[model samples]
Target: MIIGYARVSTLEQNEALQTDALDKAGCERLFTDHASGAKAHRPELDRLLDVIRDGDTLVVWKLDRLGRSVQNLVDLMNLLQSRGVGFKSLTENMDTTTPGGVLVFNVFAAMAQFERDLIRERTNAGLQAARARGHKGGRPSKLGDRERARIRELYQSRALTVQEIADQYHVSRKTIYSSIKNTR
Candidate 1:
């Protein structure tokens, strides 16, 4: 039996890539976990470990998908070996059922961690460069400075309800409140 595992760390992270690959690889069943690797409790991972039987092969899209760190990966691989379950990583072409595959897994796991570190470093450097150019990276303001000033005046006068002001400005009450608060 071939059992696949898929995971995504955050809401913005999609599992389609992992799932699609697993499907193509002909996984008999796939387990998905939507939680950070740093998080200890992965319900689906626990479930997958429980149900996987001897002579079964566990597949993953990438080496990193299965482990949080190299140490954790080593521990997991050891556990899988003891249980008589084979492990395969599609991206690294690693299958622990073979002696060469076992050798490649360790090297590939380290390379995966290195690749992730490089990605994070590049992202941080890019953000720092953007900040240097005075770009505040977030959603653009809903209201302009002129409109904000007018909203502040109207709010101070207390002549209209917040809902009325919001309706007039075509924005939410929260926006109006924020605009008023920011000017003070």
Candidate 2:
């Protein structure tokens, strides 16, 4: 069975072109999604995956219509291959059933991995630079030194529960615990 999947970003966008292409490509079953490609969940796509089985080919009008990101596309491709299902993209002329197609898909997957590594490297470098300037990341601490000291004093006295100290400072018990951890 050849199943087709089509998507449009919003209700206002039309999937007619995609559907038409899939129809022309001899898709026996079709699923349509009226959600953004970036969205993690698509009910129609999920349903299509649930019903598809080995020897079935999954077709999409374009690569972008089938995935939220390059990594997502690569992951999906690997999943389909593991399930013994083939993948075909109309625009990219990708067909996992062929040797050339498999090579192309692997190249795309490698590129996605390369892109992720570059992003991770750049982010680490930027953080290192910021640290050199004494700039810290993450949410600003809610309580100051006085508040932390008071919390420690109250905690040592055992007169107040951690929750009580947290309520007084408008912070979480975890914050109180962290303060305690840092103090000691």
Candidate 3:
């Protein structure tokens, strides 16, 4: 069984072209999603995965239609391979049933891993540089010393409720409570 999957980032984008290609490729059943490829959950794709069986082939119009990143594509391919399923990308002319296709996918996975490592290295370098510059990355406190002291005074005097203080300060009740704690 050849099962087809199609995806577009937004509802404004049409899936007709992909559907046509899948149909031409002789897909017996098709699933589609009109959502960003970066999203973790895609309903139609999830359903397709649940329905596809071992010995089945999963077809897509293009590689990007199936995944947003190379790492994601490699992960999906690994899953399909482990399940004894084959994968085919019409536009890329990639068919995992062939030796050449497997080689190509292996190369792609290596490149993806390399890219991830580069990104991690850059992020760590950036953080180290920022620390050297005396930069602390967390959000600044909402209340300063004067505001915290006032909040504590108001609470001690029994003049204002936590919710009232929060409303007056344009913050949450939790923030007011924390401010009171800081004063003590």
Off by over 4 Å in 1: 106-184
- Cα lDDT of model 3 by residue, 36-96, tens digit: 9999889999999899889999999999999878888999999999999999999999999
Task: Give candidate 3 regions above 4 Å deviation.
Answer: 8-17, 34-41, 153-159, 180-184
Per-residue lDDT of candidate 2, residues 53-133 (tens digit):
999999999999999999999998998999999999999899998999999999999999999999999999999999999
Please provide, for model 1 over 111-168, each residue's C-alpha lDDT reduced to its tens digit, 9 standing for 90 to 100.
7678779989999999999999999998999899999999988988999999999999
Write down the worst ten-residue block by lDDT for model 3.
175-184
Evaluate model 2: give its TM-score: 0.94
Sorted by lDDT (best first), the order is: 2, 3, 1
RMSD of 3: 3.0
Q: Which ranges in model 2 have alpha carbons more than 4 Å from their true place? A: none
Alpha-carbon lDDT of model 3: 0.93
Clashes of each: 0, 0, 0
lDDT of each: 0.90, 0.94, 0.93
